[model samples]
Target chain A: MLHVFGHLNPDTDAITSAVVYAGLLTRQGVEARAFRLGEPNFETAYVLRELGVELPPLLPELPAGAAVALVDHNESAQSVENLAELRVLRVVDHHKLGDLTTASPPYLRFEPVGCTGTLLLKLHREAGLSIEQQDAALMLSAILSDTLHFRSPTTTGEDRDAVDFLAPVAGIKNVEAYALAMFAAKSDLGDTPAETLLRMDYKAFPFGDPAAPQLWGIGVIETTNPGYVFRRQGELLAAMDHVKAEDGLSGVLLSVVDILNETNHTLVLGATEAKVLREAFGVETQAQLANLGHLISRKKQIVPTLERYFAPDA
Target chain B: MLHVFGHLNPDTDAITSAVVYAGLLTRQGVEARAFRLGEPNFETAYVLRELGVELPPLLPELPAGAAVALVDHNESAQSVENLAELRVLRVVDHHKLGDLTTASPPYLRFEPVGCTGTLLLKLHREAGLSIEQQDAALMLSAILSDTLHFRSPTTTGEDRDAVDFLAPVAGIKNVEAYALAMFAAKSDLGDTPAETLLRMDYKAFPFGDPAAPQLWGIGVIETTNPGYVFRRQGELLAAMDHVKAEDGLSGVLLSVVDILNETNHTLVLGATEAKVLREAFGVETQAQLANLGHLISRKKQIVPTLERYFAPDA
Candidate 1:
């Protein structure tokens, strides 16, 4: 049997991508099962419930002796535990490659797209297969979530075509309105627990000297209005402190981004070479927070900034 | 228009693969042209002459602003001069990737096959297209040459299938006989000019500190009978010395391989670190030549040995 999943911290695209790709592999006479590496965030759960699709089983790690196919990501740091032990049959990702090597070449279909759903949609068409109505909507939702309703800089023409092809079949009358509604569903995080908020879309990165104890935990919270998260800044910082202690990380930075505004306000904890950070971003820290104006992406903008700051001098 | 070519020092596979893959791309509505990076070696010229196929034009370098697609090889060192310029449309290769990156992702169809022709055959079948007779023969010749008539360690089951599928279409009554004929055409190099022999299947690599000058010119001469080339050993060594002087290289080695016997004899020119070579191969040098018994592949065996010897201390 073949097991398929995305990178850790299962988001809307990661969950829907695994499900759709497994369907494609299954139609080709492979007994493939879609699973998630971790529990889905509220937005993903809400979308699945709306589409009336049962959530795949939550799997923390890939099972031993099973052939695994990864989707959405290829970074081992963000992949399941014991990833080096299993047989990797294939990989379908949209992100840049990380530290991944196989004894033999695994079939790779990596593209620089806004979402994995866009890639799978093309794959199905190329294989002469069709995605049905309910699944098509889920796939569309993933594209919207990843590309921020086609407003992201990563959105390409293929992504627009994927949205156009699926919207009618998905019974969506207005794509703009539908995307807005989806964004609204995840907006009210005011009453949520601080830990759940921090863990929603968390990623960890290691930097500086290889021997040094330094790791950065970054969490991104997408909202229509950035002020919602800013209101609870004190509580979120306390939660970030607890998260830093639990993970034994050197620092923690949270990107509270307003997708509608295309801006992110960064709140950080822990001391890590302020001189490097100030020089890299041309911003000074104010109360452990840096107001980064007009930041749309973590992968393209925020993460690269942090990585450059943490990179040791050559 | 897409211009497709192979690596430098055009081999039989390199020349024929460009021709067949250009046919595949042309069928898919792309105006493609096949060309060779350098002059064809004896075996490639012989096969083309038998098939009544015109040789691709010798293009020593790619033109600026031309959209190019590469086949058979992908190493920048072996690729066209000024490869960083121009638009790369696609890459169809069967070797380990080198330091190659594109401004954007090109249409990559890389596989770990014995030959690029084998991969193009699979692509045609997947796209529901057929290979015509003229192109089919070209593809078959490439497979035969790269796999050493299916005796090289790189030969796989897919390569066998390709040869089987193309044998009848190429109008060959006996596969073994056809392959032996091709091998025999390249065996009689006794009367050829020493410089031409050295340029037949030559490759160069840089090693050690980039600040200091160091280069290795490795040549492989495949023959059915090793003694035919061994008889001209003195002349070959003298030619190699001249090549070293002309190129101002640190070292040069030639692998005279007997494909029928599956063994290769190595001969070196110029002074390099003898202690490094001795520890790498664990064998003493005899007359500046080493009998690398039963090693026929430069990529898999000989080049790796030289690289290990030249590798700086970890």
Candidate 2:
């Protein structure tokens, strides 16, 4: 059996992608399953429930010599354990290539679009396979979640086209209203712990050398109102410190995006270096203040900015 | 006009890819010309002269906002000056991607293959275009050059397929003879400065943190017999020092591969640190000698070893 999964922290794209792509792979004649590496976050859980699709079983670690296909991500740091030893049948991602090399060549498709769902939509079409209703809605939700409702700079014409194509198939007449509902579901952190909330959309960047390194983690909190996280800044910062110590993170940052206004406000806690962050964003060091004025998407904006800051010469 | 070029130190793959890809681009109805970032070395010059084709003009720097397509390389260190500011329309490379990101979406095709010439052959076929006689021979020569006459560990089935497909079209019934001629042309470095010979196929790897730094550069010299370069070790070491000082390179290494026997003997000259090579290959720090036992290709055999040595965790 082929086990398909995404990166570690199961976001909407990661979760839905595994499920939707596993369906595609199965239709193409593989006994594949969608496996979640962890529990889905609020947005993914809400969307899966909305689509009436059960979540895949949580897979903490991969078994030895398993045959698998990875969706949404390929980084070993964020992928299944023993990735290099396993047979990676296919990798479909939109992120920068990391150290995930296969023993033999596999089917690999990578594009610089906003979402893996965009690629999925294209792939399903290319394969002459129609997207199922639940997967269509899941695809729509995944695209919206990754692109931040098409406000992200990573949102290409292809993404807009995918949303338009899937939105109707998803039986949604009003995308704006659907996006608002989805964002609201994502916004409601409810009783989730501060560390889990912060880690929900976390991505790490390594600066300097890979060995004896300087590394920082940036976690994003996207909500309709930034005030939800900012109201609990002290608790979140303490939680960020906890994550920092656990992960050996040199710096920890939480980018709280106001989905309604399309603006970003960040809180930073540095265990070591913050020069890259300060230089890249022109933000004051060790400060939890300032609006980045209408920038919400992490892929197109935050990651790129932080990448350049971390490895300017790379 | 679309300006197309390859890496700085013009190898066969770098040079021919520009010419062949430019030919393809032009046939597909774009005004394109192959440009060279630096002067072609002996083999490229010899092959181009034999084919009765003029070398592209030497382009030391790329002007800001120039529309360009890069072939065989995407790293800014090996590409045109001001690559970040320039509009990169397309990138076709077979190497691991370094920090090459564009302001907008561009056509990108990256394959982990033996040669960029191999990629060009596949691309040309996909475009439904036939290779011209000169271009076919150039492509054949390039594949032979980069893969060390198909003996390098990086050589793949696709590369062998490309060679077989192109051999007849290139008017060479004897592929071995053709490869020998090409290798002989490359092997005759004949009075070329040691720095120039080494730089002909040099690829550098940056170690440690990008913010502060430990940097190392590796250069390979593949020949039918290693005696030519090994005989002039002192001059080569002096040239290595010159290159080290000029580039702020931490340590410089020359891997001299005896192509016929498939054995590599390396020379080491370290300005500051030799620990990476020492740790990686389990060699003495400054001993300037070791038989690497039939490891010819830098990409497959040498690079991965060096990368692991540099970053064990990565």
Candidate 3:
């Protein structure tokens, strides 16, 4: 059986895509089960509860050479620690290609869309399989969460079409209300530790040259109430410092995104990150904060810009 | 407009896949034109002539950041010189992932199938596009050539199904006879320069550590009349030596495959390749020849073995 899962810091898209993809594979006669690399974030948990679906079990360490399928991510840094030892059977992602290699070819499906849900929908259609109502709901919620209800710059026409086609099957009467409720659930941090908050949607990335790339940890907090996050800026910076040192990261960045306003206010961790932001974005960090206005989508707006900045030629 | 092309040292699948994929994109309202990175091989030329289809023009150097689509291969060592500078808009490949990175996500489609033609057929069906007679012929010929008429280890059920479905649409009554004719054309290497023969189906691969990987050139000559090739063993070895030196490759090996017998007789270039083959395959080189018996498929049989042998742990 193929063990299917997504990246660490399981967001709604990452968690839901694994389940939906596992279902698709099973329906196509492949024995597969969904697993999550980490605990689901609050929004994903809310989505699971509202849809009356059980959360996918957290993945345990598997023996080396175990066959697995990756969804929503292909980067080794964002995946399991023993990724190099495992035999990757399939990958479904929507991010820039990263340092992932296999001894043989695998089934890989990638597109520059807002979410993996859109690709899952395409997979179902191509396979001539009808989407189960639960699967449809899972995909619909993931699409809205990832695309920020079509407000994010990552939103593509294909994503919009998928939502339009799936809404009826998902039995979603008011997408706006559901999205708002999800966002509210996400924003309800409610005394969670600063480290937990910082890690909720975090990922590690390697930048600069392919050989000897510098590792960096990037975290995102998407919420309706951005002010609530900024109020704990001191604690978040301490958490970032601890993580950067523990992981030996070259830099760390935490972008607190205001979902409703569609703005980004990133917390600069140290001199390394501050200098990089200043040189890359021409924005000065004041009081340990960089007001990266209108940069709401990390996959669309942030990662690409940082990639170009750290490009070998650049 | 997207310029679609295949890898250097173009094979039948590489050349034809570019054309068929360009056609698929055009059918989807994408402005795309096929190009070839290098001259077509004898079998590809024969397939083009047999179908009365014009060969794609050789690709010209475009400015940095020009959008392009890749088919058949994706590794940088097998691609254009300035592959890193260009923007890859789409990639349809059937080989193991290599050092491919994009600033943003692109449309990537990869499968563990025998040929890119199989994946192109899937793309057309998913898009609800009818296969044109010419495109069907191109795909069928590619499948036959890449899989050696279903004799290659790389051949999958999807590849067989594709040929079965495409035979009539391609207007080919006898696939066996057609495949034999193509092979005869390919085996007609004739008085071609030894260097040309060595490069006809060659690719450079980076093995060992991805960071500062050691580059090796692997070439294959698949022919029905293996005796014709063995007669020129001296000249071929000289050609391999020249390529290894000229490219500063760590090692080079040219496998001369007997298409009829499904056997491999690889010519070891120097001490490096000899030691690797000895350690990896437990085969000793005699008279500069290493008998890699029954390992005919370079992708499915050869590269993976070499990769495992050079793995960091191993």
Candidate number with greatest lDDT? 3
Candidate 2 docks with a DockQ of: 0.08
How would you encode candidate 3's per-residue C-alpha lDDT over B1-314 as one tens digit per residue?
Answer: 89999999999998999999999998889999999998899999999999999999999988999999999988888999999899998999999887787778989999999999999999988888899999999999999999999999999999999999999999999999999999999999999999999999998888888766788889999999999998999999999989999999999999999988989999998888999999989999999999999989888888888888887778
In terms of TM-score, the best-performing candidate is: 3
Best first by DockQ, ranked? 3, 1, 2
TM-score of candidate 3 to 2 decimals: 0.96
Candidate 2: tens digits of C-alpha lDDT, residues B125-205: 766788888888888888988887778887889889999999888887888886777677778888988788878888766
**Residue A69: error of model 3 in Å?**
1.1
How would the candidate models be sorted by lDDT, starting from the highest?
Answer: 3, 2, 1
Q: Can you write out model 1's per-residue Cα lDDT over A1-314, one digit (the tens) per residue?
A: 88899978888999999999899899989899999988887778778988898999976455665688889876667888888667777778776545554434355676678888998887787778877888789889999998899777778888999999999988988989878877887776658887778878888866665446268788899889678788888889999989988988877878887888877778766456334446767767777677677766776676667655665642
Number of the candidate with higher DockQ, 1 or 3: 3
Question: If candidate 2 were superposed on the true structure by all CA atoms, what would the RMSD be?
Answer: 6.9
Residue A199 miss distance in model 3 (angstroms): 1.1
Model 2 chain A poorest 10 in a row by lDDT: A98-107
- DockQ winner among the candidates? 3
User: What DockQ, on C-alphas, does every prediction get?
Assistant: 0.14, 0.08, 0.80
* Model 3 stretches astray by more than 4 angstroms: A270-272, B270-275, B284-286
Model 1 chain B, TM? 0.93
Q: What C-alpha lDDT values do all the predictions have?
A: 0.79, 0.79, 0.92
